[model samples]
Target: MSDTQPATSQTAAVRFEDFGLSADILRALADQGYIHPTPIQAEAIPIVLQGRDVMGAAQTGTGKTAGFSLPIIQRLLAHASTSASPARHPVRALILTPTRELADQVADNVKAYSRHTPLRSAVVFGGVDMAPQTVALRAGVEILIATPGRLLDHVQQKTLNLSQTQILVLDEADRMLDMGFLPDLQRIINLLPKQRQNLMFSATFSPDIKKLAGSFLQNPVTIEVARSNATADNVTQVLYKVEEEAKKDAVTHIIRERGLKQVIVFSNTKIGASRLSRHLEKEGIKASAIHGDKTQAERMTALEAFKQGTIEVLVATDVAARGLDIAELPCVINYDLPYNAEDYVHRIGRTGRAGASGDAISLFTDKESRQLADIEKLIKHNISRLQLSGFVPARSMDRRPRYEESEERGVQAGRGSQYGRGAYGSRKEKVDPWFLKPYEPSAPTTKADDNGGAPQSSSKPQKAKVAALLGGVPKR
Candidate 1:
């Protein structure tokens, strides 16, 4: 089944009233100026409201958050009371995210939806103190949105409880797995009650995601609003094949030439993001960097500045690229190719939101030809290669040579060194990198004792005499 075709597109445009949502929720939607349901919302809301497991796949900016959040809030309000009683148990719903920004965004949506309702929600993530989170849990919350690592930490510390959770939602599951949170996810899943409802939402689902969904969901009602890995048709995508050294110049030229404002530039690494931001700053373009390495406060400051238009360009890693709710952002630039092909969608998905036209530009060097090809394959389209004036490569048709012999030698050396014997011990055989090995502390060593006390060394006590015939000095 494809997500592109709506099962009931011919049905007259759906209103929030058609979904039979609670009065408070409908009121909130009206406050937010949402008059009609998006395609994903129109289809997924009814199925989720029925308490069935749902697997939804659609590009970002399709209102998936509201699709699930609205129903979740409605269900919670119907089953639970908001009388402000101490007996009102907390944490009925748990929403897991891959990044702190997304966690906060989800929490914001939940709060907006539940504003008129008496239900309470809180967002928790790492890189911030735990005292506030602990207090929030103690006070009781109906919905808890958290990142996986911090959630696991709370579980380990007994600061949060998930035993009473009736609904579990995994948002951006693909990105969570990509960040190596599968183990933590499994741990969290094992702690939850097995009979509770499961909702897994992702922009794209690969084979691995299907396997994970199979393990967690039972006869899920799959709702896909768009084809998997398909870029939004509303986004205009283009690429430039420039020399490695001319990328920054090309980016600057394009920004000025196109008269673009409110742009997000994606870099592969934290350092690269900072470097790009600095370069843009030197060129008199205000910019900032947001990544895992930055403190929570700093990242928030940068985000606020970007949102307020104090900064024109925001350079960021993939963590900031997902689930960002910036309205009407005009452009997204790929300064560095993503290691994962799926990330291209998430990165560019930052733009073209809310039924607005957006532009996505990619810069590729000869070294990144394979990565470019992978991106094109994932999007299932050939991105038109454009040549920017003053930034074209010196050698347009140059192909980098393959260093097969050097690669073979490096592999051989790695095998030899890893298998070679050392003074401590021999290497373990067939070590799987995926396995998490426990750490073991070594025992302390003791020197020999003399007469029940520690041994003492004598100063200049012994000397080696040289033979007289050699006429050599004595050694001590």
Candidate 2:
């Protein structure tokens, strides 16, 4: 099947059934309550089924996982011979993710999609015992979803093999680069077969991502569902300027005032996430923090509690929350602005998933104005300004100009002095030490003709002349 164009108003809508999927796979979709294909899915499925490489850019809630997984599953099933058994191959497809959470989520989706087929899949990640992963590989699974670190560990141990992999997916390729996993990704790509299909998906394609794609992909089809760095149209963004000290109070106030039932609050540091969660809990709002430091059990427990409404808020670092799938989540709070501008899209993507309307709130301190500016530039939209009642900013009272704005005055004061202002009223001129010395030459001393006698030392010490030369030597 060839790739199909996006549906127009007069055209009939394309359903998953129109893609020639197996009966069992369609049954699984029905069980999951999926009737229509998302935009990414509608465009990517046909091209992928045609055995072509696809590079897709879509926001978080666009059902991109199914867009790639469903077609891969159907193609694999179509190629499977009736007499062949499912356990014959140890692996035929490999999916690499940046974080363990995303790996597990993708693995779950692949498993769910391939349920009716006679294929098996497993997920491998760090922060757990490797013996189980080894056992699963030995049992001969067909698909493997893994993180770069743990997957490399298995490859080095000679326990897992990728010689037979037919499809390769780098989900969230931008995040992989952000976590400094480019070298690992390259190593894994080197291990896979050269003829395999490649699919790279991300919320935003940065310059580094473009460079990576040039190296990995062949002549491929590029599918972009929205503009670059653009957030979902359904999400409403707002910013609150507050002091650094009173940020927690402001967040708590907003939650109480709005009566938000479920929310995800993002923090930059692990300690900050934990501290904020504790403060919220003390203020009678149930919350928990999830980060890389937490054990697998602890992370899973917190996620389950939050999903079940036992916890009202989740305080998470960027790495722990990427690729988290929560249905009907309404609010996302940037308790701390992300260090990277691209992460703003992924963070807010957790809400407004599956075509649902949502809201994102960011708390910006006076010091974080530049970060906020960068975010605005990336998103290409102005965030609505908001102020809380009874909250007065302390730094707002200071009329001191920003350092960047005072560059001219700073330069006019001095060239090499530490203090901006000189001790005298005028600027001080720097003095060179070599300029204070007199010149000397290495000319031979003339002796009297009558006496070839040795020259006697002068009674009075003659003052030594300092050399006057540019290259540190006297010219005769």
Measured by TM-score, the strongest candidate is: 1
lDDT of 1 at 118: 85
TM-score of candidate 2 versus the correct structure, residues matched by position: 0.79
On residues 281-380, what C-alpha lDDT tens digit does candidate 1 reach at each position? 9988888888777898888888888899998998988876677888899999999888689989999899998678899999988889899889989999
Cα-based lDDT at residue 157, candidate 2 = 94
Q: What is residue 234's positional error in candidate 2, in angstroms?
A: 0.5
**Prediction-by-prediction clash tally:** 0, 0
Off by over 4 Å in 2: 1-12, 79-87, 390-476
Candidate 1 residues lying further than 4 Å off, grouped into runs, are 1-12, 390-476
TM-score of 1: 0.80
Q: Write the per-residue lDDT of candidate 2 for residues 148-173, one digit (tens) a residue.
A: 99999999999998998999999999
Candidate 1 residue pairs in clash (backbone atoms < 3 Å): none
CA RMSD of each candidate after superposition: 14.6, 14.8
